[model samples]
Target: MKRPITTLFMLMSIDGKITSGDSDELDSDKDWKTIVGVKEGIGQYYDLEQCTDLWSLNSGRVMEKVGMNDKAVAQFKSPVSFVIIDNKPHLNEKGILHLCSWLKQLVIVTTNKNHPAYAMNLDNLSILYQEKFDGEKLLDELASNYKVDRLTIQSGGSMNGYFLRHKCFDYLDIVIAPLLVGGKDTTSLIDGESITSSNQLHLLSSCRLIEAQTLENSFVRLRYEVLK
Candidate 1:
């Protein structure tokens, strides 16, 4: 498949937890900022994120958890073209409009026919209706049709798992926080169906460490090439 060079970019805990908890209310953006030891170096993650690929992918669940649904913003513009995968229609019409106004382009990949994005008739907004979610095909379409060269995967763990399982991920860039959040139900970096047989081991991806840099306040930046 012809697709863009994809990078899995994220900020995760030392224990690999993406969220502070499993619930929608618990998010790394909110919870980590409140903690003393973890909050000190948290700004570094956002600072680094500003330099990532202009084309970014995120799940609607992640945006909703970050309160984009109720977020009030002034009329502004951004260079980033955002791709949101939403099936539950997590974002409302207002939120979709907000994103459309802010981003260079807002592409919504959804299975929901009644998705709020479909109602709005905006030039920046494009709805890619899918009968079933296919991460690999999505990337190919983004590259072929949308002219996306480098795509940054900033979606939730479930979407990350889909990319990982499909071997759609090309690179991994992570800012590992100093703290360790331990919870069996908490969201991890890779969450989905686990391999039960030896034949399924091919789904596992091995990383070739490209660089490991230590940032201030105990935060670490790890970059890896997904060894294909």
Candidate 2:
């Protein structure tokens, strides 16, 4: 049915350098602050406390952190139903089982059921085992079951790549922080092959949300439409 999704990205480094080529410099507090501020701002814009059909797609790593971190867990507990995607489905149970308590309908997307961790949480969580991972099909299932019209994609790199490659994103909300982390092996904000000139995104709008309250020190929010 071709459901539209909004992809939200929190990227580190002002120069678009998540990590440098050389694996030396790591851990930048300034960058982290910017990221947190942006999160807070986003939280304000949307009613996260209310239970709605809003669906969130996260990477495996994010799922683990969000499941454990009190703040993260609470954020998911609000209105949005979370769908965490991982190539290895087992990791979802092994790491982030507790946060499942917060989620109304916790969905895990994985390729196969090959790990011992997968067996433990069959009763507690909803598992969607796919022979092949297809984002479009996943969306169809979500809209059917959860009644979600608008979807958001939170990055964990490879998951972002899958959606990007499939041209599944409708809008992109990029929060760029003003800091740099210089290292080669550092995690990327998103993982995707170079989208060619033909696939470049078109700028829809760009605006700054001035941070009057909380950690946000006035961040720039850019919106783009993926030119599919």
Candidate 3:
């Protein structure tokens, strides 16, 4: 099965943590604008005017944390479709449907075959399935059905770790912030359990740095290609 090229884009602290604390709130300091360069670099690297689809794991919480409420999401005018992975129906179906009616589409990827809300007819609501939420199969369906060639993954640690564990992503784009928040409960870019010697990601064999640059705000941007 053919799959769309996947890029995991994230902002991390100097110590490799995704969030400063246990909260999902992102670092919204003025210096955060440095992320624009990373977005531009992705567009240039992929030769895309704009990304085809925006993917998220538990995107509902992300939107809420980022100050985008149901009303705000409904007002979004971007052409890019939104794809969310919600194996347990963590998001509100009504809000998702409302947002989808105003956008290109809203796709919910779930393993639950008997989701009652999805069973009801909802306009512009697409439900894609996998028995156990296989990341590769979800990507294949996105490519085959939605024609998504370049998909951007904007997610927290758990989702990022899922793709990394499965080797589903192709590229990783990271923005290193200058701030450091040290906490044992803090989240990192990857949230899975510690890997043993056999399953560790060996940089030399698994990935290669393709781009590195300092942005105007003193943030460092790094891009790496996952070696296949």
Candidate 4:
């Protein structure tokens, strides 16, 4: 398959939990702001994220959680393009407009025919609708249509698992926080259906560690090359 080089990039806790808790009210972005130990190092994560791939892949739920729909006034222009997968139509029309204001390009991939992005006519916006979502096909489109050479995956845990299972992810860049937020139902770095049989053992993603750097305030930055 012809596709862009993809990297799974995220900031997670020591125990691999992506969110602070199961509830939307308790996300790492908000909860870590006031948390003592993790708070000090949170800036490092954002700083590193800003330096990642220009082609960013995210989820609508996370965007909504970050108040994407509430921001009416558009922000300053950015060179980075945002590719969001929103099957549930999580983002409203205003959110699509808000992204168009800041992003150099905004691509909305959805299974929903009534996505708010389809209603708009923006110069920077592109919509990709599919009856059934295909992880490999999405990467192919990003590489061919958008000319995205490198895509940074910042979506939810389920999306990460999709990429992993489909062999679409090439690298991993994770910043581990000092905290350890644990709950059986809480989201993690990779959350999806577990392999049911021994025949699927090869589906597990194994990687070779490229580097492990100890950042400030007990934060650790780990990079790995995913073995295909």
Please tell me which predicted candidate would have the highest lDDT against the true structure. Answer: 1
Candidate 2 Cα errors over 4 Å, as ranges: 17-31, 34-53, 65-77, 89-96, 115-124, 195-218
The best-first sequence of candidates by lDDT reads: 1, 4, 3, 2
* Tens digits of lDDT, candidate 1, 15-61: 99998986897889998988998889899999999999999999998
Model 4 scores what on Cα lDDT?
A: 0.90
Candidate 4 Cα deviation (angstroms), residue 113: 0.6
Model 1 ranges with Cα > 4 A deviation: none
Total backbone clashes of candidate 4, pairs 3 or more residues apart or in separate chains: 0
**Which portions of model 3 miss their true places by more than 4 Å?**
24-58, 67-73, 113-120, 199-205
Candidate 3: tens digits of C-alpha lDDT, residues 1-228: 398888887767678876547765544322233455433333232333233245433455564555334453455555657787765555665566556656677787777776534765766678877777678777888889988887888776777777777777888887776666678788787776667776565522277999997764456778899887
| Stretch of 10 with least lDDT, candidate 1 | 67-76
The digit string of per-residue lDDT tens for model 2 on 1-228 reads: 546455554444545543333232332322353454444443423332232236777766554443343333343444446787766532544355554656666677778667334676544467677888888888888778767777777655556666666667766655555455555555565565655675464422233433322224454445566655
Write down the lDDT of every candidate, Cα atoms only: 0.91, 0.55, 0.66, 0.90
Q: What TM-score, over all chains together, does every model reach?
A: 0.98, 0.66, 0.76, 0.98
In terms of lDDT, model 2 sits at 0.55
Compared with the true structure, what per-residue lDDT tens digits does model 4 show for residues 41-80? 7999999998999999999999988889988847589999
Clash pairs detected, candidate 3: none
